[model samples]
Target: MSAPHFYLHNLGVPLLLAVVLFCAFDLTQLDVLISNQFYDPLTHTFVLEHDRLFEKLTHKLPRILPDTTGELAVIGMLLSFAWTLLPKGRFSAWLERVRVAPALRWLTAHRRDFIFLVVSFAITTGMVHYFKSHTSVWCPVETTLYGGIHEKREWFENFSLLHEAGEGRCWPGGHASSGFTLLALYFVARRYRWRHARALFIAVMTLGMIYGSTRVPQGWHFVSHTFWSGIIVWLSMLGTALAFYGRERLSQPALDAPRHAPETAAPGLSEGLSVSGR
Candidate 1:
């Protein structure tokens, strides 16, 4: 597909969908209404607020999984860099004979992919957390509807202007961003034309929603907060993809090359022998 076509289908369409959903949530009481379902008026708290099992399985595990993946990507990038620096001698020969050589070569070949994943993941989650810290939007648990001190405010409300003593640190859902940031994997997979790219995309979206929904029952965030997190993470990943891969590369189809293709030269090599020469 052409780059413009890809951008329109992938980035543009999803962005429009995000805008529509944002408007619906902002104009209506959907956030409160959905959160209300999980709220227990009798106990004056979200029913699953203190459910340890639910919290562990849903919230803790989901957040940890993506974090672990990001860490692995960083390790991969480091190893790829190291591989490029190895001298062409007995040591290099022994290293290549090691069982892990194939994996290292794969990483070296796709070092840019690992870099994109790591960078995008950091930027996406970082932006969400930054917004959370700055935005004065309260979590569902902090609002009066769910038995808290503050009056319920629409997401668009100017909480900063109110000069409230306790500025809320829960506008966009941080946990949701953790999961949504995995969408970077989908773009990476698509870039390489992985056979399971569609499946990966669906799985990432499902996982993101699952991670986001877990917070709703715990009153950590509203549905809108989760949706907004997805939107933000999605856009961040898209932006990073564009920055890393560029339109021309993104538009091209993956080459039908061997999985064990020979490793390209690392950065700073002769222009004729560089990784980009691939």
Candidate 2:
């Protein structure tokens, strides 16, 4: 289907789901099941950092992927675009002439998608950070249940806008956005109808899911925090995709470049979707 219709179809339900999540109070239950302060036999006090395994493996590991890996993705995309900016370079010219790898060819065929990916990731990340900074919601670790510093509070209980003291500044998952934002890839893939798009989508989402999960055990965030993050990224990517590629193209081939991007086979990603979202 055309990109505008594709995006129009996809945004409705996700936006609804995000609204539901924002209004619901469904996190304490999962926090009980997932995170807990530890009992210290010697000190007779609960130790917040008792879980050695989660601390060692899961706690900060996500930082590397989202920070280092994310930077590299942006840089790579920039380099791809940079090749075109100079108008000519020996390596660039040679690379352009050769068949290059599918990965490279995919980038070449869908420059808009790459731009969408980079831009969407940055936009979503900035948005996530904005909420994280502006809202007073505490991280799971900061809540009393998770051996944190603050008492329980609603998701948006004391938003900065209300001029109340923020209970804390940790709502929605940040690092998760690193991979979750790649939801743009799913939309980009469908635009091109690339056979491997499904796999790529899954891989990107799994990375985010894995990264988000690690934070739970460390009390860095709540289950709902990550869920909200997924929702946020989906919406962010969708809005960006619509901007880049919402218009219907004429008779261009599926591989022809257009703008915009977003993802998942969960529901909205149907058979009519082609790569370019156009």
Candidate 3:
């Protein structure tokens, strides 16, 4: 497909869907309506507001796993770069035959992938946090509807300059962004033509939505907050991919290239690594 068509199919459609969903929630009362289901007016609390099991599994684990994955990717990227600086000799040759050789080869071949992942993670998380701090939107728990002093405000009202930004910091859900950030993995897998690319894409989307939903039951965010988080993270990652790979490279067919594709380096740098394909 042409680059325009590839982008439309891959990025445009998803973006449109996200905007439509955002509008549905923002323009309507769906955010309050959905939260009402999990909320108890009598107790003025969300059903799962303080459930330890739910909090640990859905909130804590989801946040930690993505962070841990990003750290591992950073380490792998560093190791791959370090491997290139090692002098070629008996020691390096012997190391090539060891099991670590295949991993190093894979890392070297996909160095850009790791960079994209880390950059996307930072961009998404930063955007979410920035929006959260600036916006006046309150979490369900903080609004009078859930037994707080602050009166509930509509989505657009929160953006008004006259509106006082409180301590709520719940606008574009942070926990949800953590989940949607995994969308980077799907993009990377697709770029490299990983055999399970389709499955990975579906899994990431499902996981993101599930993570976002968990916050709703805890009264930590409205549904629209999660929707906006997905939109932000998706666009951030898409932009990162375009900047790193360029349209021409992204539009090209995926190749089952050798795991140790020769990178432009010292004359014999690539020769020190195995040329095997996984």
Candidate 3: tens digits of C-alpha lDDT, residues 1-278: 69779889778887898779767887788888989999998887899998999999998877777889899878876776755666678767777777666567657666666777888888878777776766767888988888987887754565645444566688787787888888888776655555566677778778888888898989998988877887778888888877766666556554454222335222222232322211
The residue-by-residue lDDT of candidate 1 on 27-143, one tens digit each, is 888888888888889889898899999998998777778989999999987786766676668887787777666666666777777778889988997777666655577887887
Where does candidate 3 clash, by residue pair? none
lDDT of prediction 3: 0.74
What residue runs in model 3 are displaced by over 4 Å at the alpha carbon? 97-102, 160-166, 252-278
Alpha carbon lDDT at 94, candidate 2: 75
TM-scores for candidates 1 onward, in order: 0.86, 0.67, 0.83
Q: Report RMSD for candidate 1.
A: 3.9
Better by TM-score, candidate 2 or 1: 1
The lDDT values for all models are 0.75, 0.61, 0.74
* Candidate 1 stretches greater than 4 Å from native: 159-166, 252-278
1 against 3, candidate with superior TM-score? 1
Using TM-score as the yardstick, the better of models 2 and 3 is 3
* TM-score, predicted candidate 2 vs. hidden true structure: 0.67
Cα misplacement distance, residue 208 of candidate 2 (Å): 2.2
